[model samples]
Target: MSTPDTLAFRFFSLHVVRTRRLGPSLVRVTFAGDDLAHFHSGGRDQSLSLFIPAEGRTEPGVPVEEGENWWQAWREQPDGVRAVMRSYTLRALRREPDEIDIDFVLHGVGPDAAVPAGPASRWAARAKAGDRVQLIGPAVTDNRAIRFRPPEGTDLVLMWGDETALPALLACVEALPAGTPVRAWVEVSDAGDVQQVSTPADAEVTWLVRDESCAEGSPMALGAIKQAELPPAAKPYVWIAGESGCVKTLRRHFVGERGIERRQVTFVGYWRRGLTEEQLRELPED
Candidate 1:
Protein backbone atom coordinates (compact mmCIF):
# COMPACT_ATOMS: atom_id res chain seq x y z
CA MET A 1 0.00 0.00 0.00
CA SER A 2 1.23 3.48 -0.87
CA THR A 3 1.12 6.09 1.88
CA PRO A 4 -0.58 9.28 0.73
CA ASP A 5 0.29 12.70 2.08
CA THR A 6 -0.87 13.40 5.63
CA LEU A 7 -3.22 16.24 4.61
CA ALA A 8 -5.37 14.92 1.80
CA PHE A 9 -8.66 13.23 1.00
CA ARG A 10 -8.38 10.16 -1.22
CA PHE A 11 -10.42 7.30 -2.56
CA PHE A 12 -9.63 3.78 -1.44
CA SER A 13 -11.15 0.64 -2.87
CA LEU A 14 -12.29 -1.73 -0.13
CA HIS A 15 -14.05 -5.09 -0.05
CA VAL A 16 -16.51 -6.51 2.47
CA VAL A 17 -14.83 -9.14 4.64
CA ARG A 18 -17.44 -9.84 7.31
CA THR A 19 -20.85 -8.88 8.69
CA ARG A 20 -22.49 -8.99 12.13
CA ARG A 21 -25.99 -8.48 13.51
CA LEU A 22 -25.52 -6.04 16.37
CA GLY A 23 -29.16 -5.64 17.36
CA PRO A 24 -32.70 -5.78 16.03
CA SER A 25 -32.12 -2.74 13.80
CA LEU A 26 -28.38 -2.46 13.29
CA VAL A 27 -26.05 -4.40 10.99
CA ARG A 28 -22.29 -4.09 10.95
CA VAL A 29 -20.33 -4.51 7.73
CA THR A 30 -16.60 -4.88 8.02
CA PHE A 31 -14.38 -4.15 5.00
CA ALA A 32 -10.73 -4.62 4.25
CA GLY A 33 -8.18 -3.55 1.63
CA ASP A 34 -4.47 -3.15 1.32
CA ASP A 35 -4.96 0.59 0.74
CA LEU A 36 -6.70 1.08 4.08
CA ALA A 37 -3.29 1.19 5.73
CA HIS A 38 -3.17 4.74 4.42
CA PHE A 39 -6.59 5.68 5.81
CA HIS A 40 -6.46 8.05 8.76
CA SER A 41 -9.52 8.42 10.99
CA GLY A 42 -9.51 10.91 13.89
CA GLY A 43 -11.48 8.37 15.98
CA ARG A 44 -14.54 10.14 17.43
CA ASP A 45 -17.47 10.68 15.05
CA GLN A 46 -15.18 10.48 12.02
CA SER A 47 -17.21 10.28 8.82
CA LEU A 48 -16.56 8.80 5.38
CA SER A 49 -18.42 9.05 2.09
CA LEU A 50 -18.82 5.64 0.46
CA PHE A 51 -19.66 4.99 -3.18
CA ILE A 52 -21.31 1.60 -3.21
CA PRO A 53 -22.01 -0.37 -6.35
CA ALA A 54 -25.53 -1.69 -6.72
CA GLU A 55 -26.06 -5.24 -5.47
CA GLY A 56 -24.60 -7.92 -7.76
CA ARG A 57 -22.20 -5.35 -9.23
CA THR A 58 -18.53 -6.05 -8.51
CA GLU A 59 -16.59 -2.93 -9.40
CA PRO A 60 -16.94 0.50 -7.77
CA GLY A 61 -15.59 2.90 -10.38
CA VAL A 62 -13.74 5.58 -8.46
CA PRO A 63 -12.01 8.00 -10.80
CA VAL A 64 -8.23 7.83 -10.95
CA GLU A 65 -8.09 11.59 -10.66
CA GLU A 66 -6.89 13.05 -7.35
CA GLY A 67 -7.02 16.72 -6.32
CA GLU A 68 -9.57 19.55 -6.38
CA ASN A 69 -13.05 19.01 -7.86
CA TRP A 70 -12.92 15.22 -7.76
CA TRP A 71 -16.58 15.34 -6.76
CA GLN A 72 -17.45 17.29 -9.90
CA ALA A 73 -15.97 14.49 -11.97
CA TRP A 74 -17.94 11.91 -10.02
CA ARG A 75 -21.14 13.91 -10.52
CA GLU A 76 -20.64 13.98 -14.30
CA GLN A 77 -20.97 10.20 -14.60
CA PRO A 78 -24.15 8.79 -16.07
CA ASP A 79 -26.89 8.07 -13.53
CA GLY A 80 -27.19 4.43 -14.58
CA VAL A 81 -23.53 3.65 -13.96
CA ARG A 82 -23.02 5.90 -10.96
CA ALA A 83 -22.75 4.26 -7.54
CA VAL A 84 -24.88 5.16 -4.52
CA MET A 85 -22.97 7.63 -2.35
CA ARG A 86 -23.79 8.14 1.32
CA SER A 87 -22.03 9.54 4.38
CA TYR A 88 -21.50 7.20 7.33
CA THR A 89 -19.54 7.25 10.55
CA LEU A 90 -16.53 4.96 10.94
CA ARG A 91 -17.62 2.54 13.66
CA ALA A 92 -14.13 1.12 14.10
CA LEU A 93 -10.77 1.03 12.36
CA ARG A 94 -7.98 -1.54 12.67
CA ARG A 95 -4.65 -1.17 10.89
CA GLU A 96 -2.82 -4.34 11.87
CA PRO A 97 -4.45 -6.04 8.88
CA ASP A 98 -6.12 -2.99 7.32
CA GLU A 99 -9.85 -3.17 8.14
CA ILE A 100 -12.79 -0.91 9.06
CA ASP A 101 -16.35 -1.37 10.31
CA ILE A 102 -19.53 0.52 9.49
CA ASP A 103 -22.88 0.12 11.23
CA PHE A 104 -26.02 0.77 9.19
CA VAL A 105 -29.46 1.31 10.70
CA LEU A 106 -32.04 -0.87 8.94
CA HIS A 107 -34.92 1.62 8.84
CA GLY A 108 -37.99 2.21 6.63
CA VAL A 109 -40.40 -0.48 7.68
CA GLY A 110 -42.38 -2.31 5.02
CA PRO A 111 -45.97 -3.52 5.26
CA ASP A 112 -46.59 -6.37 7.74
CA ALA A 113 -43.82 -5.06 10.01
CA ALA A 114 -41.04 -5.83 7.55
CA VAL A 115 -37.80 -3.96 7.09
CA PRO A 116 -37.41 -1.98 3.87
CA ALA A 117 -34.59 -3.27 1.68
CA GLY A 118 -33.33 0.06 0.42
CA PRO A 119 -29.99 0.53 -1.36
CA ALA A 120 -27.67 0.85 1.63
CA SER A 121 -29.80 -1.15 4.03
CA ARG A 122 -30.17 -4.00 1.59
CA TRP A 123 -26.44 -4.08 0.90
CA ALA A 124 -25.54 -4.13 4.58
CA ALA A 125 -28.19 -6.63 5.62
CA ARG A 126 -27.08 -9.09 2.94
CA ALA A 127 -23.47 -8.10 2.49
CA LYS A 128 -21.12 -10.95 1.62
CA ALA A 129 -17.38 -11.25 1.54
CA GLY A 130 -15.67 -9.91 -1.60
CA ASP A 131 -18.28 -7.15 -2.09
CA ARG A 132 -16.44 -4.10 -3.35
CA VAL A 133 -16.99 -0.36 -2.67
CA GLN A 134 -15.15 2.94 -2.87
CA LEU A 135 -14.54 5.09 0.20
CA ILE A 136 -13.64 8.78 0.02
CA GLY A 137 -12.26 9.88 3.37
CA PRO A 138 -9.47 11.58 5.18
CA ALA A 139 -5.93 10.46 4.45
CA VAL A 140 -5.02 12.64 7.43
CA THR A 141 -6.01 12.85 11.09
CA ASP A 142 -7.35 16.42 11.30
CA ASN A 143 -10.13 16.63 8.69
CA ARG A 144 -12.70 19.40 9.14
CA ALA A 145 -15.88 17.29 9.43
CA ILE A 146 -14.66 15.66 12.66
CA ARG A 147 -17.08 17.70 14.83
CA PHE A 148 -16.02 16.68 18.37
CA ARG A 149 -14.29 19.90 19.35
CA PRO A 150 -15.28 21.35 22.72
CA PRO A 151 -13.93 24.67 23.86
CA GLU A 152 -11.50 24.88 26.76
CA GLY A 153 -12.84 24.93 30.32
CA THR A 154 -15.71 22.62 29.32
CA ASP A 155 -16.62 20.55 32.41
CA LEU A 156 -19.51 18.41 31.20
CA VAL A 157 -20.45 16.59 27.99
CA LEU A 158 -24.11 16.21 27.00
CA MET A 159 -25.20 14.20 23.96
CA TRP A 160 -28.50 13.34 22.28
CA GLY A 161 -28.71 11.05 19.29
CA ASP A 162 -31.06 8.76 17.43
CA GLU A 163 -29.89 5.39 16.17
CA THR A 164 -28.00 7.00 13.30
CA ALA A 165 -25.61 8.79 15.63
CA LEU A 166 -25.20 6.01 18.15
CA PRO A 167 -21.94 4.67 16.70
CA ALA A 168 -20.37 8.10 16.67
CA LEU A 169 -21.56 8.96 20.16
CA LEU A 170 -20.27 5.68 21.49
CA ALA A 171 -16.94 6.23 19.80
CA CYS A 172 -16.70 9.56 21.61
CA VAL A 173 -17.49 7.93 24.95
CA GLU A 174 -14.94 5.19 24.39
CA ALA A 175 -12.22 7.76 23.87
CA LEU A 176 -13.06 10.38 26.48
CA PRO A 177 -10.52 10.92 29.24
CA ALA A 178 -11.21 8.76 32.27
CA GLY A 179 -13.26 10.45 35.00
CA THR A 180 -14.74 13.10 32.63
CA PRO A 181 -18.43 13.70 33.29
CA VAL A 182 -20.89 12.77 30.51
CA ARG A 183 -24.63 12.48 30.04
CA ALA A 184 -26.34 11.03 26.96
CA TRP A 185 -29.89 10.55 25.77
CA VAL A 186 -30.23 8.10 22.90
CA GLU A 187 -33.45 7.24 21.08
CA VAL A 188 -34.06 4.02 19.22
CA SER A 189 -37.03 2.19 17.68
CA ASP A 190 -37.66 -0.50 20.32
CA ALA A 191 -36.26 -2.17 23.39
CA GLY A 192 -34.41 -4.66 21.21
CA ASP A 193 -32.66 -1.80 19.46
CA VAL A 194 -30.92 -0.67 22.63
CA GLN A 195 -27.12 -1.10 22.45
CA GLN A 196 -24.66 -1.46 25.27
CA VAL A 197 -22.28 1.47 25.51
CA SER A 198 -19.58 1.82 28.16
CA THR A 199 -17.22 4.64 29.08
CA PRO A 200 -14.64 5.35 31.71
CA ALA A 201 -16.14 8.74 32.45
CA ASP A 202 -18.68 9.44 35.16
CA ALA A 203 -21.26 8.56 32.57
CA GLU A 204 -25.05 8.29 32.60
CA VAL A 205 -26.96 7.17 29.50
CA THR A 206 -30.74 7.16 29.06
CA TRP A 207 -32.26 5.18 26.25
CA LEU A 208 -35.65 6.23 24.82
CA VAL A 209 -37.44 3.63 22.75
CA ARG A 210 -40.02 4.92 20.27
CA ASP A 211 -43.28 3.11 19.80
CA GLU A 212 -45.62 3.11 16.79
CA SER A 213 -47.75 5.85 18.34
CA CYS A 214 -44.79 8.22 18.55
CA ALA A 215 -44.81 10.98 15.95
CA GLU A 216 -41.74 11.72 13.89
CA GLY A 217 -39.09 14.24 14.91
CA SER A 218 -39.67 16.60 17.85
CA PRO A 219 -43.04 16.01 19.49
CA MET A 220 -42.20 13.05 21.69
CA ALA A 221 -38.51 13.84 21.64
CA LEU A 222 -39.06 17.27 23.18
CA GLY A 223 -41.40 15.83 25.80
CA ALA A 224 -38.79 13.28 26.80
CA ILE A 225 -36.13 15.95 27.05
CA LYS A 226 -38.27 18.13 29.25
CA GLN A 227 -39.07 15.28 31.58
CA ALA A 228 -35.47 14.35 32.33
CA GLU A 229 -33.67 16.02 35.22
CA LEU A 230 -30.36 17.03 33.66
CA PRO A 231 -27.16 17.08 35.65
CA PRO A 232 -26.16 20.58 36.58
CA ALA A 233 -22.82 21.76 35.23
CA ALA A 234 -21.35 25.21 35.03
CA LYS A 235 -20.05 24.61 31.52
CA PRO A 236 -21.69 21.84 29.49
CA TYR A 237 -20.78 20.86 25.95
CA VAL A 238 -23.91 19.62 24.23
CA TRP A 239 -23.87 17.51 21.07
CA ILE A 240 -27.05 16.73 19.16
CA ALA A 241 -27.77 14.85 15.95
CA GLY A 242 -30.37 12.68 14.18
CA GLU A 243 -33.49 14.13 12.44
CA SER A 244 -32.94 17.61 10.98
CA GLY A 245 -36.06 19.27 12.34
CA CYS A 246 -35.65 17.56 15.68
CA VAL A 247 -32.06 18.68 15.90
CA LYS A 248 -33.07 22.25 15.18
CA THR A 249 -35.73 22.13 17.88
CA LEU A 250 -33.28 20.79 20.44
CA ARG A 251 -30.70 23.39 19.45
CA ARG A 252 -33.17 26.16 20.19
CA HIS A 253 -34.31 24.57 23.43
CA PHE A 254 -30.78 24.23 24.75
CA VAL A 255 -29.88 27.77 23.96
CA GLY A 256 -33.22 29.46 24.66
CA GLU A 257 -34.92 27.41 27.38
CA ARG A 258 -31.89 25.92 29.09
CA GLY A 259 -29.99 29.24 29.07
CA ILE A 260 -26.90 27.73 27.42
CA GLU A 261 -24.89 29.87 25.05
CA ARG A 262 -25.13 29.15 21.35
CA ARG A 263 -21.37 28.53 21.16
CA GLN A 264 -21.52 25.86 23.84
CA VAL A 265 -23.45 23.45 21.64
CA THR A 266 -22.41 21.45 18.59
CA PHE A 267 -25.15 20.05 16.38
CA VAL A 268 -25.58 18.31 13.04
CA GLY A 269 -28.71 17.27 11.15
CA TYR A 270 -27.83 13.71 10.07
CA TRP A 271 -31.09 13.17 8.23
CA ARG A 272 -34.65 14.46 7.85
CA ARG A 273 -38.16 13.10 8.50
CA GLY A 274 -39.18 12.30 4.91
CA LEU A 275 -36.18 12.90 2.64
CA THR A 276 -33.39 10.71 1.37
CA GLU A 277 -29.77 11.49 2.12
CA GLU A 278 -29.27 13.06 -1.29
CA GLN A 279 -32.34 15.25 -0.87
CA LEU A 280 -31.27 16.15 2.67
CA ARG A 281 -27.87 17.26 1.34
CA GLU A 282 -29.47 19.79 -1.00
CA LEU A 283 -31.19 21.66 1.81
CA PRO A 284 -29.57 24.57 3.65
CA GLU A 285 -28.07 23.70 7.03
CA ASP A 286 -30.50 24.31 9.91
Candidate 2:
Protein backbone atom coordinates (compact mmCIF):
# COMPACT_ATOMS: atom_id res chain seq x y z
CA MET A 1 0.00 0.00 0.00
CA SER A 2 1.04 3.67 -0.47
CA THR A 3 1.12 6.38 2.15
CA PRO A 4 -1.75 8.49 3.55
CA ASP A 5 -4.38 6.25 1.96
CA THR A 6 -3.71 2.92 0.27
CA LEU A 7 -4.71 3.34 -3.35
CA ALA A 8 -4.28 -0.06 -5.00
CA PHE A 9 -0.51 0.26 -5.33
CA ARG A 10 0.94 -3.18 -6.04
CA PHE A 11 4.23 -4.71 -7.03
CA PHE A 12 4.57 -6.23 -10.47
CA SER A 13 7.39 -7.68 -12.49
CA LEU A 14 7.85 -6.06 -15.87
CA HIS A 15 10.22 -6.68 -18.77
CA VAL A 16 11.46 -4.50 -21.58
CA VAL A 17 10.21 -5.71 -24.93
CA ARG A 18 11.23 -2.85 -27.19
CA THR A 19 13.09 0.44 -27.10
CA ARG A 20 13.22 3.41 -29.47
CA ARG A 21 14.53 6.93 -29.53
CA LEU A 22 11.75 9.44 -29.84
CA GLY A 23 13.90 12.55 -30.05
CA PRO A 24 17.30 13.86 -29.07
CA SER A 25 16.91 13.22 -25.34
CA LEU A 26 13.77 11.07 -25.15
CA VAL A 27 13.90 7.28 -25.21
CA ARG A 28 10.66 5.34 -25.28
CA VAL A 29 10.75 1.97 -23.53
CA THR A 30 7.82 -0.38 -23.94
CA PHE A 31 7.13 -3.02 -21.32
CA ALA A 32 4.79 -5.99 -21.27
CA GLY A 33 3.69 -8.33 -18.52
CA ASP A 34 1.13 -11.03 -17.93
CA ASP A 35 -0.36 -9.06 -15.07
CA LEU A 36 -0.92 -5.91 -17.13
CA ALA A 37 -4.49 -6.98 -17.69
CA HIS A 38 -4.97 -6.38 -13.99
CA PHE A 39 -3.38 -2.95 -14.15
CA HIS A 40 -5.46 0.16 -14.44
CA SER A 41 -3.97 3.58 -15.18
CA GLY A 42 -5.93 6.81 -15.37
CA GLY A 43 -3.81 7.92 -18.31
CA ARG A 44 -3.32 11.66 -18.03
CA ASP A 45 0.00 12.25 -16.24
CA GLN A 46 -0.24 8.92 -14.43
CA SER A 47 3.06 8.00 -12.80
CA LEU A 48 4.62 4.92 -11.19
CA SER A 49 7.80 3.90 -9.45
CA LEU A 50 10.38 1.75 -11.25
CA PHE A 51 13.09 -0.30 -9.56
CA ILE A 52 16.14 -0.58 -11.80
CA PRO A 53 19.03 -2.81 -10.86
CA ALA A 54 22.54 -1.49 -10.65
CA GLU A 55 25.18 -2.11 -13.31
CA GLY A 56 25.76 -5.76 -14.24
CA ARG A 57 22.63 -6.79 -12.32
CA THR A 58 19.61 -7.87 -14.32
CA GLU A 59 16.78 -8.22 -11.80
CA PRO A 60 15.64 -5.53 -9.41
CA GLY A 61 15.61 -6.81 -5.80
CA VAL A 62 12.38 -5.41 -4.48
CA PRO A 63 9.74 -7.29 -2.52
CA VAL A 64 6.69 -8.39 -4.47
CA GLU A 65 4.65 -10.01 -1.69
CA GLU A 66 5.09 -7.58 1.19
CA GLY A 67 1.93 -5.62 0.40
CA GLU A 68 1.92 -2.63 2.76
CA ASN A 69 5.42 -3.51 3.99
CA TRP A 70 6.85 -3.74 0.50
CA TRP A 71 8.65 -0.41 0.55
CA GLN A 72 10.03 -1.03 4.04
CA ALA A 73 11.65 -4.29 2.93
CA TRP A 74 13.09 -2.67 -0.16
CA ARG A 75 14.51 0.17 1.88
CA GLU A 76 16.07 -2.26 4.37
CA GLN A 77 18.03 -4.06 1.68
CA PRO A 78 21.79 -3.64 1.49
CA ASP A 79 22.56 -0.50 -0.43
CA GLY A 80 24.89 -2.34 -2.73
CA VAL A 81 22.22 -4.83 -3.84
CA ARG A 82 19.16 -2.60 -3.77
CA ALA A 83 17.75 -1.40 -7.02
CA VAL A 84 17.79 2.32 -7.74
CA MET A 85 14.19 3.38 -7.89
CA ARG A 86 12.81 6.39 -9.75
CA SER A 87 9.38 7.75 -10.52
CA TYR A 88 8.28 8.36 -14.13
CA THR A 89 5.16 9.16 -16.07
CA LEU A 90 3.20 6.92 -18.40
CA ARG A 91 3.56 8.19 -21.99
CA ALA A 92 1.22 5.71 -23.54
CA LEU A 93 -0.93 2.81 -22.34
CA ARG A 94 -2.46 0.23 -24.67
CA ARG A 95 -5.01 -1.99 -23.02
CA GLU A 96 -5.60 -4.48 -25.82
CA PRO A 97 -2.25 -6.30 -25.58
CA ASP A 98 -1.32 -5.33 -22.04
CA GLU A 99 1.51 -2.97 -22.79
CA ILE A 100 2.69 0.44 -21.49
CA ASP A 101 5.16 3.02 -22.75
CA ILE A 102 7.42 5.24 -20.68
CA ASP A 103 9.54 7.97 -22.16
CA PHE A 104 12.83 8.63 -20.35
CA VAL A 105 14.95 11.73 -20.74
CA LEU A 106 18.59 11.05 -21.70
CA HIS A 107 20.51 13.88 -20.08
CA GLY A 108 24.08 12.96 -20.93
CA VAL A 109 24.35 12.38 -24.66
CA GLY A 110 21.30 12.12 -26.82
CA PRO A 111 19.15 15.06 -25.78
CA ASP A 112 21.24 16.29 -22.87
CA ALA A 113 25.01 16.86 -22.78
CA ALA A 114 27.68 18.54 -20.65
CA VAL A 115 26.78 16.27 -17.72
CA PRO A 116 26.85 12.67 -16.57
CA ALA A 117 23.99 10.26 -17.03
CA GLY A 118 21.64 9.32 -14.19
CA PRO A 119 20.69 5.75 -13.39
CA ALA A 120 17.39 5.80 -15.26
CA SER A 121 18.85 7.50 -18.33
CA ARG A 122 21.78 5.08 -18.37
CA TRP A 123 19.42 2.10 -18.16
CA ALA A 124 17.28 3.43 -20.99
CA ALA A 125 20.31 4.10 -23.15
CA ARG A 126 21.65 0.57 -22.87
CA ALA A 127 18.44 -1.36 -22.25
CA LYS A 128 17.60 -4.18 -24.64
CA ALA A 129 14.90 -6.75 -25.01
CA GLY A 130 14.29 -9.13 -22.08
CA ASP A 131 15.67 -6.75 -19.45
CA ARG A 132 13.37 -7.05 -16.45
CA VAL A 133 12.60 -4.64 -13.62
CA GLN A 134 10.26 -4.40 -10.68
CA LEU A 135 7.50 -1.83 -10.42
CA ILE A 136 5.19 -0.54 -7.71
CA GLY A 137 2.16 0.90 -9.44
CA PRO A 138 -1.60 0.93 -9.35
CA ALA A 139 -4.12 -1.79 -10.12
CA VAL A 140 -6.96 0.73 -9.91
CA THR A 141 -7.55 4.19 -11.38
CA ASP A 142 -8.07 6.46 -8.38
CA ASN A 143 -4.55 6.46 -6.96
CA ARG A 144 -3.10 9.37 -5.00
CA ALA A 145 -0.24 9.80 -7.47
CA ILE A 146 -2.42 11.05 -10.31
CA ARG A 147 -2.35 14.81 -9.72
CA PHE A 148 -3.76 16.27 -12.96
CA ARG A 149 -7.11 16.92 -11.38
CA PRO A 150 -8.83 19.88 -13.03
CA PRO A 151 -11.96 20.85 -11.21
CA GLU A 152 -15.35 20.96 -12.90
CA GLY A 153 -16.13 24.07 -14.99
CA THR A 154 -12.54 24.88 -15.81
CA ASP A 155 -12.40 27.37 -18.69
CA LEU A 156 -8.75 27.03 -19.64
CA VAL A 157 -5.51 25.27 -18.74
CA LEU A 158 -2.04 26.69 -18.27
CA MET A 159 0.92 24.32 -17.99
CA TRP A 160 4.68 24.50 -17.55
CA GLY A 161 7.31 21.77 -17.47
CA ASP A 162 10.88 20.94 -18.36
CA GLU A 163 12.44 17.92 -20.03
CA THR A 164 11.80 15.62 -17.07
CA ALA A 165 8.14 16.55 -16.99
CA LEU A 166 7.58 16.67 -20.76
CA PRO A 167 6.04 13.25 -21.12
CA ALA A 168 3.46 13.91 -18.42
CA LEU A 169 2.68 17.38 -19.74
CA LEU A 170 2.30 16.12 -23.28
CA ALA A 171 0.11 13.28 -22.14
CA CYS A 172 -2.14 15.69 -20.31
CA VAL A 173 -2.26 17.99 -23.30
CA GLU A 174 -3.24 15.24 -25.72
CA ALA A 175 -5.99 14.00 -23.46
CA LEU A 176 -7.73 17.31 -23.02
CA PRO A 177 -11.26 17.62 -24.32
CA ALA A 178 -11.73 18.89 -27.85
CA GLY A 179 -12.09 22.68 -28.14
CA THR A 180 -10.71 23.19 -24.63
CA PRO A 181 -8.25 26.05 -24.48
CA VAL A 182 -4.73 25.25 -23.33
CA ARG A 183 -1.56 27.28 -23.09
CA ALA A 184 1.65 25.32 -22.37
CA TRP A 185 5.31 26.18 -22.05
CA VAL A 186 7.79 23.32 -22.41
CA GLU A 187 11.50 23.77 -21.83
CA VAL A 188 14.01 21.31 -23.24
CA SER A 189 17.78 21.05 -23.39
CA ASP A 190 17.96 21.97 -27.07
CA ALA A 191 16.07 22.18 -30.30
CA GLY A 192 16.62 18.47 -30.90
CA ASP A 193 14.67 17.68 -27.78
CA VAL A 194 11.52 19.11 -29.33
CA GLN A 195 8.91 16.64 -30.62
CA GLN A 196 5.56 16.95 -32.29
CA VAL A 197 2.54 16.41 -30.06
CA SER A 198 -1.01 16.09 -31.32
CA THR A 199 -3.95 17.38 -29.31
CA PRO A 200 -7.54 18.20 -29.96
CA ALA A 201 -7.65 21.05 -27.50
CA ASP A 202 -7.29 24.59 -28.82
CA ALA A 203 -3.76 24.19 -27.63
CA GLU A 204 -0.93 26.67 -28.02
CA VAL A 205 2.55 25.42 -27.13
CA THR A 206 5.69 27.51 -26.86
CA TRP A 207 8.85 25.39 -26.67
CA LEU A 208 11.77 26.94 -24.79
CA VAL A 209 15.10 25.53 -25.95
CA ARG A 210 17.83 25.74 -23.37
CA ASP A 211 21.57 26.16 -23.69
CA GLU A 212 23.92 23.90 -21.77
CA SER A 213 24.45 26.37 -18.94
CA CYS A 214 20.74 26.65 -18.26
CA ALA A 215 19.79 23.06 -19.02
CA GLU A 216 18.52 22.20 -15.55
CA GLY A 217 17.08 25.23 -13.77
CA SER A 218 17.14 28.38 -15.82
CA PRO A 219 14.72 31.25 -15.48
CA MET A 220 14.17 31.38 -19.27
CA ALA A 221 10.75 29.77 -19.21
CA LEU A 222 9.50 31.90 -16.38
CA GLY A 223 10.72 35.01 -18.14
CA ALA A 224 8.88 34.00 -21.24
CA ILE A 225 5.73 33.32 -19.20
CA LYS A 226 5.83 36.83 -17.79
CA GLN A 227 5.79 38.26 -21.29
CA ALA A 228 3.28 35.77 -22.69
CA GLU A 229 -0.23 36.82 -23.53
CA LEU A 230 -2.66 34.22 -22.25
CA PRO A 231 -5.98 33.74 -23.96
CA PRO A 232 -9.01 35.11 -22.21
CA ALA A 233 -10.21 32.83 -19.47
CA ALA A 234 -11.25 33.30 -15.87
CA LYS A 235 -11.28 29.77 -14.49
CA PRO A 236 -7.84 28.72 -15.65
CA TYR A 237 -6.49 25.41 -14.42
CA VAL A 238 -2.73 25.42 -14.01
CA TRP A 239 -0.28 22.51 -13.67
CA ILE A 240 3.44 22.80 -13.16
CA ALA A 241 6.06 20.06 -12.73
CA GLY A 242 9.79 19.70 -12.96
CA GLU A 243 12.69 20.75 -10.71
CA SER A 244 11.52 21.56 -7.17
CA GLY A 245 12.95 25.04 -6.93
CA CYS A 246 11.61 26.03 -10.32
CA VAL A 247 8.22 24.54 -9.59
CA LYS A 248 7.99 26.55 -6.40
CA THR A 249 9.04 29.72 -8.13
CA LEU A 250 6.49 29.21 -10.88
CA ARG A 251 3.80 28.51 -8.29
CA ARG A 252 4.51 31.83 -6.61
CA HIS A 253 4.37 33.63 -9.94
CA PHE A 254 1.01 32.15 -10.72
CA VAL A 255 -0.49 32.89 -7.35
CA GLY A 256 1.27 36.00 -6.16
CA GLU A 257 1.92 37.75 -9.45
CA ARG A 258 -0.77 36.55 -11.81
CA GLY A 259 -3.36 36.73 -9.04
CA ILE A 260 -4.68 33.24 -9.71
CA GLU A 261 -6.03 31.56 -6.65
CA ARG A 262 -3.50 29.18 -5.15
CA ARG A 263 -6.15 26.50 -4.98
CA GLN A 264 -6.76 26.63 -8.73
CA VAL A 265 -3.32 25.28 -9.49
CA THR A 266 -1.93 21.78 -9.00
CA PHE A 267 1.85 21.62 -8.90
CA VAL A 268 4.37 18.83 -8.23
CA GLY A 269 8.09 18.79 -7.97
CA TYR A 270 8.95 15.72 -10.00
CA TRP A 271 12.58 16.10 -8.98
CA ARG A 272 14.97 18.67 -7.65
CA ARG A 273 18.21 20.15 -8.78
CA GLY A 274 21.39 19.02 -6.92
CA LEU A 275 19.38 16.32 -5.09
CA THR A 276 18.15 12.83 -5.75
CA GLU A 277 14.53 11.78 -5.52
CA GLU A 278 15.33 9.93 -2.32
CA GLN A 279 16.61 13.13 -0.76
CA LEU A 280 13.64 15.12 -2.00
CA ARG A 281 11.30 12.49 -0.60
CA GLU A 282 12.92 12.72 2.82
CA LEU A 283 12.13 16.44 3.19
CA PRO A 284 9.72 17.02 6.06
CA GLU A 285 6.19 18.13 5.21
CA ASP A 286 5.40 21.74 6.01
Best by TM-score: 2
Cα lDDT tens digits for candidate 1, 1-286: 1323336777788999999988878988999998898888775888788888855666765554644555666667776566788889888888788899999988753355544556887667778999999887788888876888777888889888888998898888878888888888888886887877777888888888876575566566678777878778899898998887888999998899988898999998788777888787777754
Off by over 4 Å in 1: 1-6, 66-69, 109-115, 284-286
Candidate 1: lDDT over CA atoms? 0.80
lDDT of 2: 0.85
Quote each prediction's TM-score. 0.91, 0.93
Per-residue error (Å), model 2, residue 109: 4.0
In model 2, the runs with Cα more than 4 Å from the true position are 1-7, 110-112, 214-216
